[model samples]
Target: MASAENESLDHVPLFPLNAAVLPGGRIPLQLFEPRYLDMLAGCLREQRGFVVVLLREGSDVGSQAVFYDIGTYVRIVDFQQLDNGLLGITAEGLWKVAVNRSWRAPDGLNLGDAERLPEEPEDVLPSGHSELAAVLRALLRHPVINKLDLSVDFSSAREVGWRLTELLPLDSQEKQRLLEIQDPLQRLDRLSSLLDAMD
Candidate 1:
């Protein structure tokens, strides 16, 4: 007989938020609110992953609160209880996903299921992508007050572009668009255009 727990996984748990969690990346969260504190507790108790659903449209409540469906399943990689009673933590990406449903919990926090997508290729990032990366590298090279601490994670020009884009403190909406673009090549193209426009 199939276990109900196993079956529930088929319909992944949704922990929707007004944010974009990139694949091949880490999302640090402050679990302060009760609803989210419960959400994290549930994850820990069940050992089941939850989806970080992105909110796009509607009022900040009920089904209307969520918009963009794509997201990544995140696992708590590290955590600590702060003096402010908030859980300071980092969630490491496990899978890219598309939302299958959206709804509101009794507490009025957001939640939704996400269709996990496979990862992009491990090949070289396109030339255009590399160009943007060069720009970013130069920018990072110049130290500044409160500079972003970054790490180089790409092997080729193409990956370098996308990886750099991920590292930057870009807007959540823009980052969500990048995660939704499954094609690595096309993603690099889009990133190239976005970075060029910024210049």
Candidate 2:
């Protein structure tokens, strides 16, 4: 494993595996392919975070995945071994970053340099929007999400943003865009639209 100092900073790797990971969100992945299984072993051993950029071009299946200019740096939070010998793992994103450049490593992991996104406007939900409250409340009660935690926090803009971003079933690309957006209120506004559409 590389030195811990090298493990941190902008040395994050890119998987771009047809998925997006929002800040403060968790993503579960199944490691089966030899290349990716090796990548997983590297990360687990090094405690290095990596990127999960969405697959934007070519056939959704069998296409080479590329790192989005923007991505979430995720740390593996849990892991399991399946009957098939594949590694099952869930990762929670710790930060959002912009990919400066990336390439596939000979060892099979996608390696890349990244720049962390600068802090942005507060992601506070617009207050006193009774319509929003009603819509979200109703949305929270949906059969699909009835068992979820839909609680909101007006006190913390980040909390509100995190809850909205993670609870929604948005497309990976859309979620990626939201992750890189700097204006928090704007992010909330976009999230509001997503929630409204769900209702």
Candidate 3:
């Protein structure tokens, strides 16, 4: 995994999905598309990663797919051949980035010039928001989330906010909005409001 200190705004391959993955989160992907398989191969050989952008328009299979400018830079952490013969990979998000330009490669892969966005500084979780951590702890008890074996710091605002954003049953647009917020506390506040509305 590339450390945040070494991240640069260099050209990278883009993986656009209907869902969003924020920094400090992990996602599973199944690769059968030749373009993505090739992209995966290159990333592994280079010891680098690709950016995951939320699709704004069009299908992920075609060249016409459009995505939001903000995205998460992720590194392949684990992989294996699935029983169905597809390649399954687990990727961990490292940080957020902003796409400056994007185009389709000859092999139909989306490539982009992206700049690394600033990460939220570590902030102590406010005492008033302790229930948010309690809520997340309950959510993590689900077998699906439990299998991820996530490492979380309940006292850190950034980790709590990002993890909650990833775990919540929020729509793609709502998740994208949380991902774009620069302040961890503000993000948590927005999440608190959203949670309230859910009830």
136-175 per-residue lDDT for model 2 (tens digits): 4565676655533334554555655654555567876777
Q: What is the lDDT of residue 33 in candidate 1?
A: 64
For model 3, how does the per-residue alpha-carbon lDDT over 1-199 read when each residue is reduced to its tens digit?
5566775556799999977777778888899999999999999888899999988889888778988999999988899999999999988898899999998899899999998888689899999899899999999899978877788899999999999988899887888899899999999899999999999
Which regions of candidate 3 deviate over 4 angstroms? Answer: 1-4
Instruction: Kindly list the per-residue Cα lDDT of model 1 for residues 94-178, writing each as its tens digit.
Output: 6676677766777756666555566666667555455666765675575641132445555554345445545656676887777
* Candidate 1 local distance difference test against the native: 0.62
Error (Å) of candidate 1 at residue 41 is 0.9
Q: How are the candidates ranked when ordered by lDDT, highest leading?
A: 3, 2, 1
lDDT of 3: 0.89
TM-score against native, each model: 0.74, 0.75, 0.94
Give the residue spans of candidate 1 off by over 4 A: 1-11, 58-64, 135-152, 156-165, 169-172
Residue pairs clashing, model 2: none
Q: Which residue pairs collide, candidate 3?
A: none
